[model samples]
Target: MISRILCTAFVLCACISTTILCINFKEQQWYYVISTVFSNVSNNDYIDIDLKTAHISRNVYGISGFIDVKRDIPDDAITIEIQMSRSVSGSNNYVVLPFKYKENILYCWLNNMYRDILMPSFGNCSNALQLGNREFKGPLVKKKFEFNKCLVNVDTLPKYLIPAIYKIEFKSNGLAKIYVQLIVRVYNKVF
Candidate 1:
């Protein structure tokens, strides 16, 4: 009798707890969608700037670009970094490794730059003076794993260093691509 009573009480508590959880889970979401703009600039930082053609191929993947300041440039003038979301293959969307750039993630923070859509920079660049991906460093970013679509951000960087050019080469495990919806934004400082 005692054993049966304890089991029944346990079951009741479990049911009640589950009910409370369901009630609380019926709350608001944590994320929100937003408007977009990926306009292009007339410079070299953009190697394949096209919304119409940016696509992941069936066998291969990746993306890279020239940071066009619209004129002659230099090194160490700017800094750049990128963060990509999880990449899901066409075969199985859920089974993914997601994208990661280990370099920029090093030297400072412990949090990975993969969750939300964001723009990252490496060196000093004015909020107004724009820098680009690899525009200040010009390093080739290799892939850590595979997936599909991912959002990317290119920040101008901290504005203490000189202005320079850069290139961002994004390689991957699948045949994914980069598309430009509109010029992300325009920079007032022309090269």
Candidate 2:
């Protein structure tokens, strides 16, 4: 009788905790959405200046550009998405990675950049960054790349160094030229 009573109590506590968690999650609100304005340097070269202060020279191969987070994210943000766009059509390849601000510098926080480049079975991006498998399509025809549901550790990095830089790499197979644009969106899910 004692064991049965203890088991019942444990189950009840677990259920209550889960309910509270769900309620809190659902209460999350929209914080901010950052989109950039682009200037075309050439046929396949575009950069968003509002977010970063980098010079994108030669459209062929470069860092493309960086996105700056205008404000600090909430500690309880459940997911983040960084959407990217290009300037060529047909099909190609690309990768976008997240970086973190620590102390006074920025370091590659997650290797989601390699998630699409690396084989499907092998991905080294932080578990929080890789909510699930990621995919990227070539060609500027379809302009938009999204990093979905990034699991960020708020306790450790509630605020990033001003103007967080998210790097993007473009691999056009040396066949096509491409430019770029970006938008960042954060959300708190009910689930």
Candidate 3:
């Protein structure tokens, strides 16, 4: 009889405690900014791109892999679209050409993360004169340009994050920063 009474009381206490202590799991986020080591991008001195490790888990989550990228250097040489390969892909936020130029202020809640820019398959973008734009304009030289290698931390976390390859190359040295918005969701099951 006593054991039965104790069991009943324990169950009641557990139910009451759960009602009082429901958990609303808060989502995690990160974002960072990167600047070229060089003061001014020039022929002798060039802007460098680098990559760093990023993870989604509260603890012990990290990502690393081969990053492959492709940039559409149009025939006219006016606009270019940088796209990532299927294998070299990332989760959460990504870069759009319009947001490529801020490095002073760091936005809160979401912090942008960047790592050393490793030359994936083609370091070509970093080397080409147009990409490799000749600092000193020659007979064919037209304008100066810059590009970015970046990823964003989204509010919504990805279901699965795999190896990603992102490309960054703009028609102007004015292009410096990238923007990304993330949206993450958390579900809890109470039985």
Candidate 4:
């Protein structure tokens, strides 16, 4: 009877160990890959977008670009909307994701929020703007704001992203109008 109890305990411990190993393996096997990045500007009288570099190399994506603000935009004047969608298999249509974020650029910048969800995959607007010799705090001045060699950090992404093609759209309205789109693929990494 003692031997049977020992055998059962050993089997239980083995099963628990196997389960832990599998969980760790699964977590380490998934990663993100950026497929494409596109930016568009409408009503150029107020602003112009110039994407100097937007490309994916070695499964990593980077964007180097600038936006020329023609006029000074006051705080609370610029509102941004972000929408995400997933591409349907064998179809040109995309299914909209349940996630949508809309807020004022000034508020987001001041609060230092939504770093993981912002464009060019930046941690914050102020920091991203600093790379281009600009600032996003207070009034947006009439000047060229830039973000150079901005990369998407996978570690900042959500823990679980479905393995599929996703398209993220960013729209800015109010003082100026701008649009940006990003297409990416989430896949499993082969060992």
Maximum-lDDT candidate:
4
Candidate 1 residue runs with Cα over 4 Å from true position: 1-35, 45-48, 52-78, 81-138, 141-191
Q: Count backbone overlaps in model 3.
A: 32
The worst-scoring run of ten residues by lDDT in candidate 4 lies at 125-134
Global lDDT of each candidate = 0.31, 0.31, 0.30, 0.68
lDDT value, residue 132 of candidate 3: 29
Better of 2 and 3 by lDDT: 2
Residues 34-103, candidate 3, lDDT per residue (tens digit)?
2111121222222223233345344322222221212322223222222222212344354442434343
Each prediction's RMSD to truth = 17.8, 17.5, 15.1, 4.6
Which residue runs of candidate 2 sit more than 4 Å off their true CA positions?
A: 15-32, 37-41, 44-176
- What is the C-alpha lDDT profile of model 1 across 16-107, one tens digit per residue? 99997676545421221112334242333422232211334542222223222332323222222333332123121222123335433221
At residue 51, what lDDT does model 2 achieve? Answer: 20
Question: Could you give the candidate ranking by lDDT, starting with the highest?
Answer: 4, 2, 1, 3
**Highest TM-score model number:** 4
lDDT for 34 in candidate 3 is 23
Candidate 4 overall Cα lDDT vs. reference? 0.68
- What is candidate 2's lDDT per residue for 43-100, written digit by digit as tens? 2222122222223333211122332222332222212223433222213332333432
Which of the predicted structures, 1 or 3, would earn the higher TM-score when compared with the native? 1
Q: Candidate 2: lDDT of 62?
A: 16
Estimate TM-scores for all models.
0.22, 0.26, 0.19, 0.72
